[model samples]
Target: MLNNIGLPGLLLIAVIVLVLFGKGKVSSLMGEVGKGITAFKKGVKDSAEELEKSSADAARDVTPPPSDKDKV
Candidate 1:
């Protein structure tokens, strides 16, 4: 389906979009979209770090306390 829309078709669509929404508006929209993607990526990275820290803490808690058995 996408292969059918060649370069000319893509240019036509872009022209139409520019006409419907001025160049400034389109550029601004694209900038906002990029910012949103960056924010989402940052959020996912932070969440992963937090999960790792919590799991490490849980493992430490589950570990048995050291005892004095057969002291040498």
Candidate 2:
């Protein structure tokens, strides 16, 4: 059903939305959407960096000191 909405359909919908909401409201809403997207991207990048740091720490090799029982 959605596939039938071509360019004309999209333009008509845009016109109706503009008439109902006006230009300023739409522009501010879009600005808010842009900010949300930027915040989401930053969060994902920070999460990936944290994950890499944790994995690297976990991969480090550590050897225990010689125990007294092993001394001859």
- Count of steric clashes across candidates, in order: 0, 0
How close is every model to the real structure, measured as TM-score?
0.74, 0.84
Q: What lDDT tens digits, residue by residue, belong to model 1 across residues 1-72?
A: 997999999999999999999999999999999999999999999999999999999988986777788364
Looking at candidate 1, the ten consecutive residues that score lowest on lDDT are: 63-72
Minimal lDDT window, size 10, model 2? 56-65
Residue 65 in model 2: lDDT: 73
RMSD of each: 4.1, 2.2
Local distance difference test, per candidate? 0.95, 0.95
Candidate with top TM-score is: 2
The reply for model 2, stretches above 4 Å from the true place, is 62-72
